[model samples]
Target: MTHTPQKPIGSGFGPASTADEVIRGISLTGKTVVVTGGASGIGIETVRAFRSAGARVIVPARDTAKAKAALATMPDVIVEVMDLPEPTAIDRFASRVLSLTDKLDVLVNNAGVMAEPLTRDARGYEMQFAANHLGHFQLTCRLWPALVRAEGARVVALSSYGHRRAGIDFRDPHFERREYDRWVAYGRAKTANALFAVALDSIGRQWNVRAFAVHPGGIATPLACHMLPSEIEASQIFDAEGKPVIDPENNKKTPEQGAATSVWCATSPQLAGMGGVYCADCDIAIALPSDGSAEMHGVRPHAIDPISAGRLWQLSEQLTDATLD
Candidate 1:
């Protein structure tokens, strides 16, 4: 598969564009969407945008009660139970979804964990990588038939600018040999998210099921619960006076603005033939050089490399024992 160039195609929407704005005129009356983290943070905004556009939305959450409460105000939004870190739970959830729908129009892999202490799932996989990438990988594979049925389906993986921190440590991804650093682990997982999109898109495009990875900017979401106040401030997401900065140009964003790119990647007609690229601020992101001198914007070569994406896909299939075919 030829790679899609990483340069932006001048999508009219900018960083400040909110999810509602990007989806304003589009109609999804017969569409069905699954947003993994659709109960909180920018996930809520993502669900709202799709729901507003008349799509059927399903939100899978680990905590059913909390998810229901968070989304109670939104009528007809289905909330299901699925824990990303557990393989069995993911399979069961996918089965449930498949039983309900023959065609899935969109899937947003938005749920993720940020920097946390070194921990492993039952499979001994690192927590961040397990929940953020492998789990989504399994879910997408399990839902493969439905996605292909849609014929023009789109999958959006929520990656991060933090991917700049590290690439996949294929040898020590679980931190078995190397010492664990929470931030590096987070970066590795985020990189996996991007690569998953590349690989998935490469294969899925044949069935008109394209995939995209999105950096939803920095927002004051519950995703930061693992970080300290000082850490948040140090990350520049918060001001010295303890306020969340809302600078879109600098990647700081509100929940609605942060979800813009994900919504765009999923529903924008401008991206009909495009996939396998990293997106941010409602446009395909520019690819950064491998030299590592560029600022914390755009995608690194490793995250979008077709070879790495294929390698990661194989590794993920082995780790999760899941396959699309």
Candidate 2:
């Protein structure tokens, strides 16, 4: 696939566009949305904003009881037990969802595990890569039919700045013989998320289904809980005032702020004819410098490279034997 270097298309929204702001005039009354990790943090907030906009949000969570309790006060929000760490669970959950809904307007791959001690999923894939990328990859394929049935469906893969640190290591993704650094694993997974969107868009565009990868910016959310206090201190994410340090000039978005990009990508008319782009601050991101360094302006070349995306897709199919066309 050939990718064009991205340029903002005058979205009329910026870094501060809240979720509510993005869907201001839209009504999702009969639309169905699936949000992973919708029981907490930006994910839950995303659920709330979508539900309020009239979408019946389905939250697939690891803990059914916990998700039910957390969403007890929210109407039109249903909880289903699904654990991404277990591929079988995801398969089961997707089957159940398909039985209930014929069309899906939005699918948000928002659940993720950050830097943690090395671990593996039930299938023996590295935990960070499995939960963060492959699980979502499989789920999207399982849900493809429903997405194609909808008039216009969108898939949002939540990527992050951490992608800057690493690219997918197709040669040794399972970390079978190599020492593992948690951050590097997380980076690989996040990079996979971006690549997934690239390939998904290539295949789904004909069905009026577009895929977008998003960087929600720096938000103080549970997604960062794996880091120690010392790491947080060194991150300079907080200000002397103890509030989340926001550098307006540099453009850091809060959770509500961060969510804007996903919501925007999912709904904004500005993207009516668009697909397969890395988005931040509620707009398509500028392309990274072709040199491929961490300190670049846009997505890493490897992340959206067609050859890499296709390679990962084929590996993923072999890993799970999930061949969805």
How much does candidate 2 score in TM-score?
0.95
Model 1 ranges off by over 4 Å: none
lDDT to native, each model: 0.93, 0.85
Per-candidate TM-scores read 0.98, 0.95
lDDT of 2 by residue, 206-287 (tens): 8889999998887877878899888888877788776887753355557788778888888788788688888888888877
Best by lDDT: 1
Q: Evaluate residue 118 in candidate 1 and report its C-alpha lDDT on the 0 to 100 scale.
A: 86
For model 2, the stretches where C-alpha displacement exceeds 4 angstroms are 1-5, 248-251, 291-297
| Weakest ten-residue segment in model 2 by summed lDDT | 289-298
Quick one: best TM-score, which candidate?
Answer: 1
Candidate 2 C-alpha error for residue 109, in Å: 0.5
